[model samples]
Target: MLLNNLTKKFKHWLPLAKSKIEKGASQLENSINNYDPKEIIPSKLIERLNTKLNSLPVYESYYDTLTINVHDYIHQWIINKEQNRKNCLVIKGNCVDNLYNILTSIFSEKSSLSKETIELDYQIFSLENLKQNRRDRLNYLQEKILEIQQQSDKKIILIPDLSYYFSRTIEGLEVLEKLLKLLDEDENKFWIIGCNHWLWLFLVKIYHWDAYIENARDLPLLSQENLQDILLPVLDLVEFDWNDLRRFLVELPNQNEDDHKIISQLQAKYFENLANLSQGCLGTASQLCFYSLRYVKNEETELSNLKINNPQLPDFPSITQSDRYLLFCIGLHGHLNKSDLANILGDDQIYITSQIECLVNLNLIHFLDHQNIAINPLFYSKLTKDLKDNHFLVESD
Candidate 1:
């Protein structure tokens, strides 16, 4: 019965998704042709992307479709955060607003999802306002999604923002666990999980050592085309020449020396490293390269430090390749077999297997008998406990 239902959903949905992504890529290509990379896009990265997308065939499935509705997860977590004022709710407002707008616009013809016409106060964290206002706002948005999902019979397309949730801490992981549970139960859902800078780093830390190893096993080989597709957008956004940008930074009318020097160093090194990325791996390379140029928090700085000094790490080229593979896995749906892992990670499947062995030894993840990987059993139990203890549905201030 499950197989039959899944077959029906896939047949109905995959073609639709292929069309949407092809449209998105095509639209991006047009945007690049019509505008300058430096002035038009947020990042100076369009030419490289335009080239990559143009090179690839549009009708094929470039990557897996795994849409998990994080808004439901956020709605539940916000309720908990407000209930327990002790822990700071770390979510940024812009991210949540973007998510809400995306959800509402999917079901609209014009794709206008903002509440500009509505009279509700956008700020809900004030001391003077009633708490009910915030709850009401979130509930209203929630209903909008439920209606769309039910009306479309789950044809809702999802492109989740990586910034929507932080997974470095136990609380953040709690949110993801709940999200996975919801996704695990749903059918006919299509999504692309964008694990941008912060989320990428979070995965490196929280996915237990054992689970990480298990995940490393049976991993799909990262396709060159897939790497290019993913990286092109990032390159469009993040690629910048330090020498050129330095002049802009230094000669700006309002600049200070201290800030200028730091920005100069970061930008120079970032551009320098990016120049070495091969044509195939340019997209992921550019994305991570771009993230490094930004003002990373202290935690990120510490993580950077660890990767630099680690002895088991490969040469610069191999390390970046491995990193891109990991990113692809995080965004992809379904699981891989051991042969699949060799394909994605490279011919040196033994080394990849050894790395997985290391992660298992360290207790990051667990191997399921069914050729799939899971978070460690103990971490799974702990995650369950945290979800129950912090579940917004059952909590009261």
Candidate 2:
């Protein structure tokens, strides 16, 4: 079901201004802090909610939706393979869509129903550890490609996250060209490559990468319906008492519908705002959903009160242009370690470390692991616009 026009028209797209983000964040914080202790909802319900949320994989539901369309794209290639023998299909995912994980989940039992004996050779190219010697690192992958080339058998090779295989710097660009050349030359080996949207755009501009791929599909932007699909099943386990937002619920289209349908609409709007806030990123939306949940037990009204607080992107802290460039680079690569990020920026490790710490403090970029730092999904919607406004060549998606 679609969100009503009123909700659609009012979808909040926060601006690039640090002050505005900070102000909204502050307001949300105040509202939460001011909640009465006597009105505190039970910890038991909170625990139960946590259990349900933890059970849901990062973006399995959203990825399931993505797979349907992706399979269609793959199916088209399967049918048309003999006509042109064109092999690579690069998928460009919106900056924060967890596109990498989506690619991995494509072969789930539910999606793998096509009785096709496609002996798929899948490789996730993670070049994080090979920073010191990319040339050698690529040699191993190159050998694998060459081996596949020698095989007369038709191969369906999947390389999820092309961003992992190369750095965004000049050296990375040259390496990408070599890798792409190997893939392009072997028409028999149908290659399916997944890449970050911003990185794809950057490559397109630099190398006319789009021309090389010839076949590309961008994952669709998630909507409130999509967000609710992912969330409501989990939300169903806990009774949420959205007292603060009760007044805002619109009348259902028909009075004869279930009287409780109003509750569902309110929940839908709750996720609608969330989808807008997170800009269609399931990971961000999930985190926001979890944090925004608060328990309230108001003596004034006897009700099960699992509250959903309005979530805002944490303040866009004041940052220098250098911070923007560093953040953008991290986005382009999906994630980059301090050394690699510094290498890309041509800055000293000491200087880059300071910037990384400052950004982590500001909730801009966060460490995915001990070594890799990536843009925080929570701030993705605002940050992408921030980068674009600064003319950082950020992807439009």
Candidate 3:
């Protein structure tokens, strides 16, 4: 009886032990096969941090109202011109990005009219070749205007950044005034001009640009919905994992039908926060989104395991009286080279250099090129408001 009982127990234990051995072999094989010589395993804390950053939005598109309105304006202008009306359209905006979008949209043949649209980057052209070819620049513009005037088919002449040539000096302002007068005299060609709102304001005070271009429109501010529309389409093109994003806040071993609903609500809130933080400025919103994605607390860690924090607007440093004046000067001109800034401030280059470096470190301004510096777009709208409130800018009637 004892022998028979022992035989039965062994029979039962044999299969159980074999199953355990097979499971162990399978796990060992997986470990060997998955081993990578170059892979560095991150700490649990770092892994958690990286997982958080992967949840934030990445900026992918330039969204705005300017592009759509530009197309509509050009089509309307062409139609108006056909009725023997000689009208010039001036597009003025606070942001250079908006102005650039309008110019590019018109030039890309987005309009209904099939006529040729000639585009000029007066700012870049003036900065590069104007010193050696000032006469050439003027002549070139005149020739384009004259050529478009003679064409039987409707042609549009676009001078984006028209205020680039309008220097604050007496002689420079006079030259710009004369050029506008000449353009105003032309009754044959359809002209579309893009000017910075600040520069436009200054020019109006000096030369009354309203008299020269009777039809002027400000680029409309983009709403939160508009910003969403621009970003979602781009997001669709990429291989984005909603699951990875959802895992950031709530960890579910398996996805359920309600997971989609939860993730959607979270995403909406995230984007809404972004829109509010940027104050409906598309460029600022874009920059903020990009910085959030690219930001890392520790540079030495692997990018895949890096946790990124939501980017916040810089707390602008307290400005001295002189720094306030410097900011106003830059805002007035849109952008200024160091030499031009020195001239405006009536300070020596060495003194100006120290000031500019301080501003740069404070993240109030940035270099556009080797020498030219401009106010940071993120702070531009607020800074302009402060300047106006402090009586630095002239109030409009």
Q: Write the per-residue lDDT of candidate 3 for residues 50-138, one digit (tens) a residue.
A: 33333333222222344445456656665665432345667776643445444544443434233333342112122334542224444
Q: How far in Å is the alpha carbon of 98 misplaced in model 3?
A: 5.7
TM per candidate? 0.23, 0.72, 0.63
lDDT of 1 at 289: 36
TM-score of model 1 vs. true structure: 0.23
1 or 2: which has the higher TM-score? 2
Q: lDDT of each structure?
A: 0.33, 0.65, 0.56
Model 2, 1-397: lDDT tens per residue? 3577446434421122343456457546755876466454465654676567556664555555555654665566677765332567777776555665677656433334244534544444443455533345456566666666677666566676766666766666666777778766665566768887788878877677766677777765678887787777777876657545565555433545564785566676788889888777776786677667666665688654667776656656566676788887888877777777777787657555645665676668766557777777778777877877888874434
Report how far residue 92 has shifted in candidate 3, in Å: 2.1
Which pairs in model 2 have colliding backbones?
A: 39-297, 41-295
lDDT of 1 by residue, 272-350 (tens): 4434332222333333333334322245444221011100111121112232343233222112345544444444454
Score residue 113 of candidate 3 by CA lDDT: 33
- Every model: Cα RMSD to truth: 23.0, 11.2, 23.7
TM-score, cand. 3 vs. native: 0.63
